[model samples]
Target: MTDSTSISLPADQRRREFIGGAKATFPLIVGAIPFGIIFGTLAEPSGLSAVGALAMSIIVFAGSSQFIVLGLLAAGAALPVIIATTFVVNLRHILYAANLVPKVRHLPQRWRILMAFGLTDETFAAVSSRYLQQEDIREAHWFYLGSFCAMYGNWVLCTAIGVALGEIFPDMTQWGLDFAMSVTFIGMVMPYLKNKPMWAAVIVAGAMAIATAALPHKLGLIIAALSGVAVGLSLQMLLTQTNTHSPAPDKEPQ
Candidate 1:
């Protein structure tokens, strides 16, 4: 399960995988639509032209960083500062990529590149669950593709709708649509709290976020994320050590 090469799949299964991924990603997509819309709604008033907003949605495609970019633009932050801040906010994606590289390392260069472009928090959540369950993981990339495409397409479409409605509802961004994404993430993560390390990570991260909320430019998010990662890693190391040192369970006599 640790390493897999892309294997030829039967056509029907490929279709099934793709469709399955889309379905798995559907709820998150629904949750994200509002966030995407709010991004477009805020972008114009935040000093980005309509074309610029749409381009950022398409090119950047990271919702958190997009919002940060818009805020920094509106505040007249220098270009280097904006870039550095956004980069820091998005450093989590590097963790995501590292987690997935072993699963897809043997795929074609083009396939790897495409998946890299399509990777997102939502897609990673959905596809990582699928990859863990599927023994025939070679075809799981198609599922990833489906989830990524659905999210990407949904974001583009929602951005357009928000842009068109931006004039009609100048205060749409203030309506609190972005909170749905938080609910969606909670839903996604709730199912994965299978061990102590995960619970510790979640608890520590939440506390850190609240404690650091006043920090500027979304630094709280990065700090909380790193704190959570550290807690999880330390707990896992302790667990590993405990398991390695403990005596094996006694075998029952037949």
Candidate 2:
């Protein structure tokens, strides 16, 4: 009895952590549903079959990249061009991985690989928030797994629904469901703008995105992201140097 109890304790704790992670991600999941459905609805008109659309959701599982690919296909882009464009668009994941390295560095190779596969914008936002607040690190990956599974399952399911609706309605995409995702992105970003550097990065990125909106193959987004990162880093360094060089105030008499 004692041995069985001991063996079950850690498993129970992990289950709780996983459930907690999924619960925390529920709101974000709500925001992504319409986006996923929209992608499904657009896929067929953009030259993809229903099976292909569902497969992309299950295999590629990247909403933005999938949408870009659909547009490129509709435009009759070359295969290499489509591949290159998606690669450039996904470069932001590198920065996300950099921010998360220290937290997951101690994990084994298999664990790290699984986490990398599951990393998405929503998962990153949800998991990073949990990591920041939670003191215990031992079971955190369970929480990550939970969030990943919830989002992944939701996306695939929503894609299927959209595909069905596409056949039935044939005008579902015209309803403007993509706007929900834009609002969801804003919700994700607003919480992180607690400092000057963050604010500057967002403002610069937004302005640059608009200014360069006509660039081909979505290169404007990459340029805007890079510009924002550069400005933020430069300002952070300058502020650190200024604080280091400034003289201290005189103390009161001891």
lDDT string, candidate 1, 171-224, tens digits? 887788888999989988898899999999999999999999998767898899
> For model 1, what is the C-alpha lDDT against the true structure?
0.90
lDDT of each: 0.90, 0.91
Question: Which residue runs of candidate 1 sit more than 4 Å off their true CA positions?
Answer: 1-9, 248-254
Candidate with best TM-score:
2
Query: Candidate 2, after superposition: displacement of residue 230 in Å?
Result: 1.7
For model 2, residues 182-239, the per-residue Cα lDDT tens digits are 9888988898898899899999999999999999778898899999999998998989
Look at candidate 2 and tell me the lDDT of residue 200: 93
Model 2 scores worst on lDDT over the 10 consecutive residues at: 1-10
Candidate 2 contains a number of clashing pairs equal to 0
Candidate 1 lDDT trough over 10 residues, lowest sum: 1-10
